[model samples]
Target chain A: MIHLQNVEKVYQTKTIETVALNNINLEVGKSEFVSVMGPSGCGKSTMLNIMGLLDLPSDGKVMIDGQTFEAYSDKALAQFRNQTLGFIFQSYHLINDLSVIDNVELPLLYRNVNRKERKRLASEALEKVGLGNRMKHFPTQLSGGQKQRVAIARAIVGKPKIILADEPTGNLDSVMGNEVMDILLKLNEIDDTTIVMVTHDETMARKTHRLVRLFDGTQVN
Target chain B: MIRHLFLIIWNQKRRNFGLILEIFFSFLVLFAVLTFIIDKYNYYRQPLGFEYQNVWSIYQDTKGAPKEEVFATQEQIRNALKSFPEIIDFTFTNSNIPYGSSRSITSLKKGDKEIDADIFTVDEHFASTLGMSLSEGRWFNESDRAAGYKPVIINGVFKEEAFGDEPAAGQMVEDYNDNPLKIIGVVDQYKYRGEFVKPFAGFFQRVDTTFAVRSLLLHVRSNADAKFEERLNKRLDQIASNWSFEINYLDEMRKSTLRETKIPMLIFIIISAFLVFNVALGLFGVLWYNINKRKQEIGIRRAMGASKSGIGRQFVGEVLVISTLSLALGTFFAVQFPLLKVFSVQAGVYFLSIVVSAILIYLIAFTCSLYPSVQAAKLQPAVALHDE
Candidate 1:
């Protein structure tokens, strides 16, 4: 579950001020899949960043799983994110230097998991994403679809309660996009995971449980 | 954490090879310079065994005069020096004086143990004039002229090399010609070749008087100034009108010898400093470039739950790992110096230099990685992800 009340973001410079998100209020129920649709520079990614706690809102309150995070230190926030949140970027930001298994094991490295347990869990996550055979392959050696699958494995490796995906399938073709979407849907339905995705495709937005639209800086619906 | 860092570094070995090579060469240079400085410092702190203060060496040039006439002029010069109250004591010796460039080396043998040593021929008053203390027995006296064996005073180093732990006094060792030389006494040490050199085995052979000597070591009073040197030179001219005298203060010669040893070391230090500076700059540049190239990776790590401090520590840890690898190779080569006995320096000096060089390289790596790592840590995760 997530809640945002009067969330606003502003980008300021010496001579100009531009509103990124203005007076935004939204809520999503537990285990619900939601998608945000918008054009370029419509503050859709900004709201997702605020929800993921990657960036702070200029003026607002944010609550996740019934707890306010205004007083959390950077270290505590990072730990909270490790325990409760997972993120997937559009470009599949897997480290090119690390193998597929190593990239998937990144999230568990910050936790108290031992190396053997981490390897086992990472292997299971890769298997769930149909990437068990490519564990030793590096990011550069994999195709775009396979890289996205590896990124998905990384996002779910720690079994986070909430997954924030910014354009998860934006860089893939139609077939790969449908496959990634099906995996996301299976995770939501079977594992009861909460996912909030941002996309410019109407078909992808229509596949979620609910849709929210944003134009300029305010919510349209 | 260390394992993770090592994995990352190992995977990127090709990219890091140049930096590692730079660090390895820097470590070798640091070790060489530190070894030279430490060896010189160790030599400088030792006692030179013979006092040089308020003493002057006078070199007598007889200009190919007759042997009898030269003997008579040397006697006249001795009497003139004795008449001067400013002179405390003076000894007539051969040309092998302390801090001088001249040397006379010969071998001493006892059974199968043979040692090469410098030999100094001086009269009875040599030790008293130079303020040298005997560690075991007495110096030579007139009674030694009647002894069956030729008397010799060996230094402590010579005694240890030739006689081991046994008492050197009253022991007999044969010279190169099989003539028996008696070790009548032991002086603690006599590093006559200046402070920056290793001590060589040496001994003193006694002469009866000034008849066969060309150098005079004069122990004068503290108040003996340039005016006294001028008056003494005039008196020496009157005593031996044909012979030329070269008067040099012992303290001044000691300073000149020290300068001669230090000039080359100073140049080496300057060159090493410049080299270290350039390596530091290269290290900083490489680290900065590495951070820039890895910005997306940093963003991914941050999003995956790495704290800012964790990111900074990761960068610093990577540099430390690279430096460790380089220093490991450097130490392998450095240890061979002492093991192979490449130089006359002590093994402890080489070991100490290795430790110092390793520490210095680590410090440089840490300092060079600091600012760039801090900048990497300060990057906002969202902004960094979008930076590509």
Candidate 2:
């Protein structure tokens, strides 16, 4: 579950003050599947980042599981991020240096899970995503779609409370993108995991149970 | 945890090992040079035959003197020296100051008991002034200097060689070209050669010449100040204006004897410094590269709840792993340093140098890694995510 009240996100460079999100308020209950659709620079990813606790809003309060996170320390933020949310980035952000299993095991490593059990659970997570046979392969050795699957496996390996996909199919072909979307739908439907996906693809956004549209840093009609 | 760090360092050895070895080599060179110089200093510091603390010898640069003072005139010289309280004793000898490293050689035969010996003409005061004492018989006295005194005080080695199992006192030995000389006393060996040079039987005789002695041995009192030397030089200058030589104290000679080795030692030091510099350079570059390459990983780690200093410690731990491995390698080689002597000029202390170098190099790496790791820790994780 996630909640935002009057959230505003701003990016400031030396000579520019760009607003990414302005006075946006939204909530997603547990096990809900939500999609954020926007054109370029519309804060779709920014909203997803705030929901995932990957970035802080310039103004507003964020509450997760009935606890206010707006005042959480950086340490607490990271702890919550590691324990409560899984991220599937558009580029698959799978560590090129690690094997598939090792990449999946990374989140658990930070959780101080025992190494053996971490590997076992990571393997199980990979098996659920149909990447069990490729656990030893590096991200570079895998195709783009396979790499995304590997990243997906990495995300759910620790069994976090929520999964956030930021343009998960942006780098894949339509068929591969559909396959990735199928995987997300299966995770949400079967495991009762909350899913929030950000995408520009209208059809993909339409397939989700609910949609939030943004245009020029503000939610649209 | 340590094992994982080791694995990480191992994986990056290609990027870091050369610098590690370079630093190690530099340290090795420094240690080697320092050890060598210390050993040489010890060798040069060994005691020699004469009194070093309270003895100074004055040499006149005259080719010859007019009818060199006979025994009677030498008495006048002796009486004049007795007037000076600072002059403990005085000797007029053709040559025989320890550490002079100059020598006069001849063979002697006493009824076919042939032997070789160092030959120097000395006066009665030569023994006491130079802190030499009579070991058996009497030294050359004013009475023994009567133009034909054949008394000889053979050095200790002559006694050993001429009478290996027999006593040498009162024995008769004749110089190949001079009259038979009577063995009076046996003097202790004062090496003119290096400490490592073995002793040999040598001849010693007092030659009566018509020419004046080229040098005078002045055994000054201890605690003599600098003014005393100036005063002594002034007095000697009054004796002969044309006689422009030097007054050399035994201690000064001993110190100067090491002067020749100083430049070589300095060269060794420069070479060692050069090595150390390069080693530090190599280590610095490697650590810099490692920090930059691992920037994103460090970002991810920070994002995962690791503190800034925690990530810094991770890199430091990685550097230490590489350093420890290099030190281990260096130590193994260092243990063979003594054995390396057979094939090396700087062999004896090779191992000592290797270990010293290894520690020094690793320390340099650690210091070099600190700043970069700190920079890495301060890197914003949000900023890194945007960096691809």
Candidate 3:
């Protein structure tokens, strides 16, 4: 579960302060799929970053489950973020030097999982994403869609409570994008994984169970 | 954690190995040079059979004294020296003192065997002044002097070879001129050069020589201080005449050390410190570089509920692992250079050198990793998520 109450975000250089998000309120319940859509400079990615605990809102109370993160130590926050949220990005972000299995095992490695068990979990996660046979292949060897699938497998390996997709299909063709979306839809429906997806596509927004739009920093429900 | 650090080094062997080898060689060479010096120093001091400490040598410039000289006879000179309260004992000997630079060596022959012995002419009190202990036969008494007796004192080496301990006192050996002389005393072997240890050698002292000896050895009970030189100079001025000669202490007369080695060793130590310092710097730089290169991966890891400490540990652990591997490889090569010289090298020399170098290596690697590791452990998930 996630909640944001009247969040405000500002980006400042020496001369000016630019508001990224203004008076934004949002919530996603357990096992719910919510798509947030906005035009460029409308704060959808900024909102997603704030919800993912990757950045702080200038003025906000972000509650994950039921705790405000203002007081969480940096280490505690990092641990909380890594364990609670799964992230997918348009770029896939696979470590080029690592094999598919090593990439998937990255999160568990951070969790200090035993190497053999991490291998087992990572392979199973790769299997779930239909890339078990390609565990030893590097990101350079995989197709764009397969790379994205590996990223997805990496996401599920740690079994985080929430899956956050930020422009997950921005770099894919419609056919590949739809296939990736089908994977996410299955994950949402079959596994009941809480999903918060950010996109600029209105069609994609409509497909999710709920949609929140942002324009000029304000949310439109 | 250590294994991972090693893995990190193993991963980037090409990029890092050469510099590591350079450092290793530098330290190894430095250590080897020092060991050679120290080992030779030990060897130099090895043959000084009797302790030279609390002992001093006085150089008497006994040029042609006038017939009306104040102390002309040997008796008068000897009595004056005996009266000097600061003197513990004194004797006159030829310039071929042990560890003396002015060497006069000649081969001695007996039957078919020719043995090289350093010949020395000394006063009746020379053996007592040198504190030489006899290992087999008694040293030359006043009765065995070449002036009144045909006896010579052969060292333990000549005794071992020529007599096999069968009373070398009556054996005859020929000098370079083939002048046959009877050995009256067989004394122990001792050092001939500097403090460095050396092989077995012989010293034959002919005590009956009436020739004018140039060097006077004095064993004073005081340390090697500046004051002893003043006293010795004053005494020599009383006894010596117009021919002035340079007086040197035993250590300076040896000239066993070099100024060049000081320069190199100093420079090497400085370089060693910088080597370790630069290694640390390189380690930190590489970690930051890798972290910057992997922002997206780090972001993904953070998203997967990976702790910041875990991610930081990943990077730091990787760097530390690399450092250890570099040192191990470096040490392996380092030890090999000395180990190869085993037949030519002394055991104590190589062993001490390797141990000292290895310790420095471990310390360098360990210290180099501390700061970089701390920085790696501080990776912010938020910053990493937005990284390019």
**Over the stretch B1-388, how does candidate 1's per-residue lDDT look in tens digits?**
8888998999899999999999999999999999999999998888899889999999999998877887788888888898999999999898989998899999999878998999899989999999999999999998998988899999988999988899999999999999998889999888888888888899999865444778999999999988999999999999888889999989999999999879989998999999999999999999999999999998888888988999999999999999999999999999999999999999999999999999999999999999999999998888878877
Docking category of candidate 1: medium
Location of the lowest summed lDDT over 10 successive residues in candidate 3 chain B = B253-262
Question: Which 10-residue span in candidate 1 chain B carries the lowest summed lDDT?
Answer: B206-215
How big is the positional error of residue B118 in model 2, measured in Å on the Cα after superposition?
14
Clashing pairs in 2: B27-B357, B116-B202, B117-B202, B117-B203, B118-B202, B118-B203, B334-B351
Q: In DockQ terms, which candidate is top?
A: 1
lDDT of model 1, residue B157? 84
| Total clashes in model 3, counting residue pairs 3 or more apart in sequence or in different chains | 18
Please list the C-alpha lDDT of all candidates, in the order they appear: 0.92, 0.74, 0.71
Model 3 C-alpha lDDT per residue in residues A71-109, reported as the tens digit of each score? 898778877876887888878888776678988987776
**Candidate 1 lDDT:** 0.92
Q: Write the per-residue lDDT of candidate 2 for residues A40-127, one digit (tens) a residue.
A: 8899878877777767889998888778875777667778878888888888876566678877887887788898999899999999
Worst 10 residues of 3 chain A by lDDT: A90-99
lDDT tens per residue, model 2, B1-388? 5655775566556766675576556555666676676556544565444566777877766635455433444455467667778988888887555556577778888676777777777767777887775566777766767735488888777887787757777887888875878887777665554442345565455546644555678888776778987776676556555557577877777667545567688898888777767766666777778677777677566544555666778788887777787677666665665665543334544544565566676677788778878887777665555455
Listed models, DockQ each: 0.79, 0.25, 0.41
* Distance from true location, Cα of A59 in model 2, Å: 2.1
CA error at residue B138 for candidate 3, angstroms? 9.0
